[model samples]
Target: MKKRLDLAAFRDGILSGSRVVLGQAITLVESALDSDQELAAELIQSLMSHTGRAIRIGITGVPGVGKSTFIEAFGKMLLEKEKKVAVLAIDPSSQLTKGSILGDKTRMESLASDKRAFIRPSASGGTLGGVSGKTSEAMLLCEAAGFDVILVETVGVGQSETAVKNMVDYFLLLMLAGAGDELQGIKKGIMEMADALVIHKADGENLPSAKKAKASYQNALHLFPSSPKDWSPKVSLASSLSGLGLEETWREVLRYEYQMKESGFWESNRARQRINWLDEQIHYLLGQAFLRDSKVKQTMDHEMENVRTGILNPGTLAKKLVSLFLSTERPQ
Candidate 1:
């Protein structure tokens, strides 16, 4: 029999920046067990005072845009500056195997070995967005664990970008040279949400093309309405091979943080995110409670089959299920 995890020990270790305990804390939050969820909520409540100190940044790009490479270089640079970095890489789960491939430690060999950096790659698990549902929770845990910079890398499959954008302080879109915006398949709305656009793989012959792409994106960004933060979006070229644009990109991020903080937008944005998180959790918990009710689950298949066979209407089935769930003892 395994020893039960001590909540106090977890809390103390996290507040003291113990990576081992931090990993366990994240696992607790990600668990689907009722017991674990109860413990996770208590842990979050205790650690709430220690969170909100880190700079949360979401990094997304089109496939083949060298996202992992960029993060490797970028994270190493942050570590060089003595910043405590935590990367939550949201890996795209395979439809066939239902497992993640991109979050493997080999993808970020250098940064994974660093003492000041913590990297966690989580399977998206068919979540609506590229991010795992527990990403926000994990981020708060990281902050409580004393990480000052949190980098969230989305699956970059297009639809999940918006979900990641809402959770981060600054959103970065990585692009490749040559392909026009439309041809590249990036959604217009995603571009609008980005605080910066980084043209990746800008070494050797790609440098000129990267510069041209940078200019084009800068022009395109100018056409959009100004951001609420009063900070103009920036475009820069980056290359992991040559390490050309790491410094400038970090500088831009720092400048954006400074400007947003001065305008009070930083704190306001985080407050709004917390409210949004609350709403999301309510919806999720309600759905979970509905499905977990024994009465509902016992009738679910029958109701769905009725709807499928056209014997019952969808709306009628939903009402019946809701009523049945209400009759049960709901999870507290």
Candidate 2:
């Protein structure tokens, strides 16, 4: 038999700032087993008061924009300011084998080795928006562990940015300079959602182009409607290698936070996000229940074959499975 988890021990270790315990707690929440999930829920609920103190920031960009390196530099800057930082780097998982590279720790060796920084590379597991299903939970755990800042790095493969944006206080979009038509590289919707834009690799010969890109993006952002928070998104240049513009980026984040909080939008937005989280949980639980229903499981293979052979339409088979699943809950 497996050893049971000690919830109190885990909670105490996390509150006391034990990195090992924090990592284990995060792993518990990431587990798919029903037993582990129950424990994870209890752990999260118990630590609810400690969470939400950290500034949650979502960072996304085009591939090759150097997100991991940028995070290392940015995180190190925060550490210099006597702040604890947690990075949740979401890695793209393979569709065939479901394996992920999980190499952010390796790429961010300096930051990973820092005693004040926590780097977690989680597999996306085919989740839309390039974020793992348990990412928000992980963020909560990190916040509970007393991290002053939480940085969520998305897979940045043109997936929906809404998921990360909704969970974060600031949404940062990193862009590469001299990369073909800059405006055409990403969806305008993603741009509109950004709290700030940083043109990375703004050193050496790339400096000029980075500046030009910043100007172009600044102009484009002017056309979009102002955010409800009454804050304007700014575009700036940064270089992870030379450590340029890191402080400015941090200042921008603080400015946005200060402005939003002063206007009461910060608290209201977080409340709205919590409600959205509840809705997502409901849908997720309903899907899980539907899949686990004995009737649905027994007939699923037959229904799939029927649909494959064109004997039954997919919509009809779906409705039939839902009906069967629902009927099981009805009183006999």
RMSD of each: 2.6, 2.9
Positional deviation of residue 170's Cα in model 2 after best superposition, in angstroms:
0.2
Query: Relative to the true structure, how large is the alpha-carbon lDDT of every model?
Result: 0.83, 0.82
- Cα lDDT tens digits, model 1, 61-168, are 877788888998999999989999998856445353232424454788888888798987764464553234588889999999999999998763755677778789
The residue pairs found clashing in candidate 2 are: none
lDDT value for model 1: 0.83
Candidate 2 contains a number of clashing pairs equal to: 0
